[model samples]
Target: MKRFITGQHVSLWRLTKRVTAQNPMMKYLIKKIPPYPTPVEFWVSNVAHVTDETGFKGILKSEQFRAPKSELSWWDLKIKKEEIRAAEKNYMKRNFSNKAKEPNEQKPFLETFTTSPLFQLKKSRYGNYRFTFPLAELMEWYKEQNCGGKEPVLRVYGTVTYKQQIVYTVLIHSPEDSERFGEYPLLEASEWVRYQDGKIIWKAQAICETHRYQFVSGEVQRLKTHLFYVWDQVSLVFHLPNRTKPCKAVKIPRQRLIEALEACKLDRKIDLLRYKSPKNKEERFFEAKMKVSELKRELEEEVKEEKSEAENDIKMEVDP
Candidate 1:
């Protein structure tokens, strides 16, 4: 009959069997099971933790009740070893094949230069070169040039690698030299090795413009002229006109009046009415009074005309 046991019962059975097997006389009393034991307390603890933390409850369903014992023969071990060896060999072969596709052989700096867009044969006049200098040597040269000051300057570094090994020292140059003569220059210190396959083909130097003084100057001047033009336009738009006196009371449309004010403000021609030295306050007052008097006389004449017209109309009506 197949027997079912609780997890705790399994642990107790395994522990009892282990104790029995340790004694030669009790060994026969304990039967060896094909599948080996489970630790019930461990499972119970894990389950309790998972439940309390609200984590990984699915693991309980998949938990193994017993561990399987390995029953490998000598021949099985030999076959397994052979399989591992084959896997390793295949992995190595694949790695070598990939390396072959992209050969690790480092080409000479000149050969690399020839492949660059800036240094093609057709662009010979455009300055093309290569450099081979270790960092130490490059730093020495930099110090010699007094360019080690604490200013931000462009720097170039390059390396030549073959088979994943750096076979040549890199060269370093100031940004100016790098720009004029391709990044790699022909002129480099003697300590570095030049390589064709691993040889230096050629090196040249050219000047690079670090600061464009003329271009910057022109840009600044252009901006200044633009600002001046804008200021002139604003001045013309917002200028207030000289007011001799608050404008006379007139029933003019608001829009028309605003437009007139804006026009007067923008008008640059000097306003003759705003003479620097008005003859005197008295003169100015007298002139203003005379103007008012003339206006009053005109108004009186207009009233008289209207009155005469009304009188004539009354007479005509009586006669009729």
Candidate 2:
């Protein structure tokens, strides 16, 4: 295999970096950070190639679940291409994204990045926003239609912002219907919700955004709604079951998608409830006022119960 960085293999690199310091007074077992970031995504057309790679199969594919490896050799060995174009494109897009531009200067910065069925909503003449599907609500609706009352997890997806907030267009699967979804992930409660150890914290919230996309789907897609074109797997920028937001549009790794799909096949008794933040100042004020009132009412009830118990105790002591 060709060395990614030099004639030096990744294992050699790891061996060299195993200990940062060797002095008796200042010895430290420092783990080496990966020299290269995981490829933002495989190239759009390279997804099938990725899936076909035996070493790149199953759960090992997703960047999130990657096992520790020699950073130098990951690209040359597991992923094949140095992923130069994908990296360069991501760099360019990130450097000059619309978010950096002034309001009037923000002209346009999107194209039909993914072959998702949500676009059909945008395709309709007068039912919704004219140019785009905006993916946020469409996914939630897809879960509703396909999984019935059971929770649906987005195994892989792309992302876009709807009205300034980020949204995801994704491949969804449910845990309850294992026959149909047994191959996918059934993310465990502990894995789904992570905590802040001394090192870092992880939090995820997925609020349901209700929409009429299902009604619209009945017309345009009929029964053959797209599951998204498999070729552009890297185009999945943000996964639906993910809380971490991406700044630029990129395809998700196909290997990552498969692991998530396989793992989310079971509910795992995880409460992946998505909470919605208040949209406006008025709603925030009302929510705050209600919370305060509820707290005060509970305090009063507790005080009254305590006083009643004291009085009963005094009566018993005096009578006895």
TM-scores, all candidates, are 0.16, 0.20
lDDT of 2 by residue, 1-320 (tens): 11112111112223235322442211211322211111122222111111111222322334322222311111101112233333334533554454344434433222112122222211211111111122333334434544564555533222222221222222334444455544433322222211121111111111111111221211211223222111101122122222224311123343333322211111122212232343433343344345434545665677799999999999999995
Q: What does candidate 1's lDDT look like per residue over 1-320, in tens digits?
A: 11222111112223344433334323322433221111100000000000100111121233211111221100000012232233323323443344222223421111211121121212111111111122233233333442333211221122321111121222323344345436333323322222222122212111010111111211211122111000000000001112324211112232222221100111122122333342543453345345434545665677799999999999999995
TM-score of 1: 0.16
CA lDDT, every prediction?
0.23, 0.27
Model 2 root-mean-square deviation: 24.7
Give the candidate number with the greatest lDDT: 2
